[model samples]
Target: MSSETTYAVEFAKTSRAKCKKCSDIIEIGDIKILTTTTGGRFDVTQSFHPKCYTLPRKFAGTVDDFVDETLRDTTEGQILPKERDALVEAIKTSSSATKKSNKAPGSASSADAIIEKIKAMVDDGENEPQTKKAKRDDHYSSNEFVAAYRVYQKEKNDELKDVLKWNRQFVSGTKNYLLVKVLDGHVNGRLARCQLCQGGRLKIDEKNCSIVLCNGQFDEDAQQRIPCTFQCSIEDAPRWKPWFTEEPSEEEKEKMDKLEADATGEGAGDSHGDLASMKKEAASLEWNLSNKEGIRSATEDAIGLLKKYNAKLPEDATKAKQKIGPVILAHKRETPEDIIAALWKEVGKQLSNEEKEQKDKALEKTTKVDANAKLVAAFQELSEYYSKEANQRAVFTYSKCLNAIRGLDYEITAENAMSLSKGKTKVEGIGTAFAQKIKEFCETGTMQKLEEKRADHA
Candidate 1:
């Protein structure tokens, strides 16, 4: 693709301007006229300061293909009045050829699709609809999907990291290997490096490839390697490819390298800021019906758990029965804890031994952080198993687990909890009142059983 020597530098428009090729904004001052093949069509022209005009750079698509220097270095006094005609003619000729190529049936529909997608821009205040299109308020939402994706990205990025360094030996009789750099974070294996005095990153240099790691004097750390650290270099370093697997031009490669480098620091050639922002913008990601089906399939397992465990109901149990679904649904609609409570509350005890075993297995998959508390709470709620003292222990356990997870920076969500628990087994849906009640119960922790049982047990 053709490149821009200077950015098109958009200016705020005073009023709209219409041209044959297109109708768009016209600003107060057009400091430079961006050089384009379309000549003065103004419609397709890139408005810029004339001083910035030059031929667009070619983009080949690798990390080292292009570099931007001074305009004077490429084109200076070549700006005689006649020079404009030549540049414009060249642009028109090139653009027309591209148009013709794009129109060819065998050659260009795929290219057009990519071009259109890239060119898509929402007008200010307009939002593009996301796939599933629904947003989570409490964000306990599709915690399952998020969990799945984190795994997916981790696996995906695991395929690309390869930085190695070697250190020189001070004594001629001692050792003779270059230190190659490695990483421990999997994604960021390249952090601080040290000289061979301690641990060293080492790699074998092939005949005539690129050279990022150089043989250097030993003093301090510059890079490290895998054998010493948990994080290791990726066995194979493959080229980065677009989704379509198109090989980028040298210029494109350089662009990518710059962007990646900007995202990573000198010691670490990784980038995360842009990707994070994109994920934040794409937060509306959701799964389709298959996930819902999986949830349904897990119910028999949950039912078994209910059957094995002895059950008890409070004096107000009938009220819970009537309002449980709605309370749970409300909590599911609001907080994560309620979802677990509803799940725990709904299934009645009536299982065969095998059924109970299956339910336990299901709980393993659903064993998420939020669910852990709910499990303990559910256990404690059954006054038979939990003496007043056991109930207090339950509260302490829940608090400790939550604190520990937060300290370790792990997500504590119903879905993840459920996934970790019994094994993805859960009722299809929790209704509004049921979810709400669970949420209210967790928040208040003022259920009567604890107080009454406290006196009975003590």
Candidate 2:
């Protein structure tokens, strides 16, 4: 056989090969291209979906020249006329996109010049509306409050106590209570510190409507402590910065307003309003119970509320269904609270088992060094590159493949790399495209894809 490189196009015989560009699996019978490069005693072949195939820049020839070369004296597979045309069009489109991407910003191209003219016309306010910029605030919405509460719930009891102490809030409560208190303080704008006096701070007074400082001096005449008037919002405090950076959407704002109104008994006079409030509260508790760390406390709170309003619960509300793991835990003959309790138990078991498995896998990874460390690093680099490009699918595929490679106990050599994807000991996430990449790295000491990525970034 001639010691030359060749390319051939054919339909995929199996659904094992992944597209090089997209990192997605090509279905069986899809048009694919195989490039074979012969060097010394070993021949390496890489497969790609036809649309993903890019002509080598080193090949100084036209599309027809490359096609002629591909068609010359090859009997293994033949490219159909229509497929050949598609291949040519794909190459041209890929090349055009590559060139456009490679061009720097503000480059003096005809396309850029036209874009500049359009941008200039828009900048001159020809037909654009003069809308005022919306003012931004640091108010936490319902979703943000829930998310922040989950994070706070994950902290240790001692740490949560410290946080409450720092904020001068109530330090005596269960972990869930502390979590909810801290989050509510920020969300409701009730947590504040007096800028006038060092000893001045306020606590939530559930019974009274007056604002009295916790450490303020009591007056015998007024029969009340002096109120602090220089209070400042602690929402932008550094202590809460990590948890509450997300801004709420307009929908979240409306939901939060309604929830606050319900909490304050704004429209609880009618039975309909009372029932609606209970359902909303139950839904909020359900969301909180979704977090594994808050399961116990949230479940207790949920059970208490259910007991209080169980008789008022509608039939459909009591019969609401929840999916936990693979099993659907429904309220066939039980109350809504019973279904919730069952969900909590099932989810706790599943979470415990998952945590154990994760710990075991982490231990395994630490004990055994990756035998294909270089290849794993290359794939990791590609994953990061795809992530920077906002190619989420490609990033996920490469990340999964690299993680699988990290778990390999044996080295990937040129001899065994090809069989590693097909043999009984096949890696879980390695598709044909990644297996070929492994073989290429083992033989050439570098991946062409990685090199191209480096070149592009450079």
Candidate 3:
């Protein structure tokens, strides 16, 4: 046997390609794993689908170690249980065969010797071990609001134990203000709606110790005495700073103290407290909203509205339908009039467009076009604009979305867009956040952030 061994592993998000291992088609937008092996006089590059990738003999560790080290950069299509099992079995089979072959050469090699031989074959000067970094779950950098909200939700559901995951979630000194966070899910770059009065968008006061505030009518003086619904930011939140571990400055401490004081102070009186109590109890009270009869009636109403406006019920609306009960309960409404009123309001918002536009070049850029086309164009635009090393993550995400949409075999209408936008969609590479953008594109015919990007790039 030669003293050389293979030393490289790589992966990429790319267009359709055939898998070298199985001769099966790796569809467009799929993640492809590739490996490079170079011996004394031979070098080969092998490509495989994630599931098809085998444990390489030239690598330095076990199958699990290989996955952690080589595939750390991959964002989609992680190895599953079946694949891991298959890879492990295949590795054992190969090892047995290699020993048998070596036995004929009057050679006996220990496992450690073989491992050392393989490790030494890599050209260390060319391939440096990549330092592992924490994955950025908050793509839009909502100041960890997305992650914090997830923690808050899990706590609300009585999840057995809280698991601190994201680095941002470890942000110190967050004053958890009890603002009803509207637009609670992904809709990144879009402001959270103030659930109290819908007066203004919710914002994180990064400068004020992670307090939440209603941009519409927040008064800092009234924060402690009344339910001013002000948002706050977490002071000394973890970031890529030179001295991030340093404690908060005296001025920062003052801000945190003020924000904490506001969160516990009694404002908005008993009514506010009652509403908070109701919200806490909203999930537990079984006021009969998920019943078949109730669902049937609501479905009928929804279908009628769809028909009246020549619209169709989105597949994603199932969750929204389930939420109908909670929505009514959250508002503390028990009467039929109150429930029906709430239902109609939501229906009307979805069905009607409150904006009008005239024909013009600028209008064309901002006007609603086919949802699919808009999404593809928006992603492409983003990719081109963020074509730098620092922006690779953003570019990769946008490109993945564009490819996913292009691979869609059916028409991308508003209904389909709405359905795809739901967090539950099973599309590869596209998650809840991307889906929210797709939904926004379909609903508004244009995304405000994408257009802003266009202007900036132009």
Candidate 4:
């Protein structure tokens, strides 16, 4: 054994960097290395939990682009060491080039500009890296009116909160205002039917969400509210920022103040209410409960773990079916084709004659529950048996599982890679010059676009 040691490091999404110490996922800047120290034990390199890393990842796009471009400049002799140092200092101190005082030409508003950039990025097509739209509560159902109406019959003139289910849920302070919110499992999917379309008979757009609107006229000098007009700098929310910021009602604010006072002892002044403390607490509490444990009961754990593989279920099934499908596929990809054929043959027996035709391959086996269960059990049992033989065999099984997961996701990318990336089934009109377009292709969409163009000219 040698006292000297070397280590390998990798940068990862905060989601990937789970702190070994606290089991909280590490974020970008607040990342930790899963390192073995002098004692040869695993340790997390983060002093602050995953939450503080949230803010850094907010500017991750800018930071990464700047770092790469800066380093490239250093190599190209376009940037001096002094300039590089200044750039680093600027990044260290999060300086915002606030355009509050001056809006760019052709821009409607600063926030509109951010949204436009996001929209432009999307139009660039399937292959381009995309961030989801900033979520907002864009729609409302009349359920509240019905609920409030029920209560109104009982107490036509009751104080707020006493109005049964109404509880004066309507926001106060700003009259003639619309508070924007993300559709975070809020509102009924059925009530979202477009009132102007199909006489509002359909439940929803199904393809896209509806914009929720709240309209009211207060008796005390009726005022109307519009959409939330606050703007953002990025094309999307900072990964550190929660999906939405809520305007606390006067009552909620008083409650929060009272709780903070109680915790700090009235008049002790919110000394513990520091921003740093708030950041760390937010990160630690996110993974407060383990989905991993809750999943173990009904084969849900297996399905949950598959998410770690980046696999999605395009079909409907039970937890066992979903778990078993991937497990069997893992086994098939690793084992001999003849053995897999044999397994499918056994699986084919339980299916109807019509489905039996589909039973010649691994895909066919998964369509039937008994066959799926049999295949998964077979693989799991094989993995366990292999583990008994040697650590080397166990390693092979683990690799097979991972490989199967990757293979499926890659297949999906390749099939739709070109169209998804470019929104075209074939690439045309672009010449040898455009051929340079694919020096860095990642998804299947990009591949398809190239293959079509390449084949055309080849």
Residue lDDT tens for model 2, 230-249: 21122322121222223455
lDDT of 4 by residue, 109-226 (tens): 2223322433443354423223222212122223332232233223222232222112113223211011111121122211211111101111111212232221211121123211
Candidate with maximal lDDT: 2
Cα lDDT for residue 107, model 3? 20
lDDT of 2 at 166: 47
Candidate structures ordered by lDDT, highest first: 2, 3, 1, 4
- Candidate 2 lands at a TM-score of 0.26
**How many steric overlaps are in each model, in order?**
81, 0, 14, 17
The all-Cα superposition gives candidate 3 an RMSD in Å to the true structure of 21.7
lDDT of candidate 4 at residue 154, scale 0 to 100? 35
| lDDT of predicted model 1 | 0.31
| lDDT for model 2 | 0.51
Which of the two, 2 or 3, has more lDDT? 2
lDDT of the candidates, in the order given: 0.31, 0.51, 0.42, 0.30
Q: Which portions of model 1 miss their true places by more than 4 Å?
A: 1-26, 34-43, 49-55, 58-182, 186-458
**Tens-digit per-residue lDDT, 1-458, candidate 3:** 55543323233455455678678876655555665556546676666665655556566677667655654434344556565565556545655665676665222122223222223323222123341122222222232433334444334311211121111122222222121121122222223233322223444443432234444334342332112222223121111211111245667555444432322221221223432332343334344445657645644553443344333233345544554545454543364434444444343222122212111211222222432444565655555555522365676677677656755666566666656654666677677787777777778877777777755532
Candidate 2 off by > 4 Å: 1-4, 40-42, 70-78, 104-458
For candidate 2, which ten residues in a row score worst on lDDT?
Answer: 131-140
State in Å the error of residue 405, model 2.
22
Predictions: Cα RMSD each: 27.9, 25.7, 21.7, 27.1
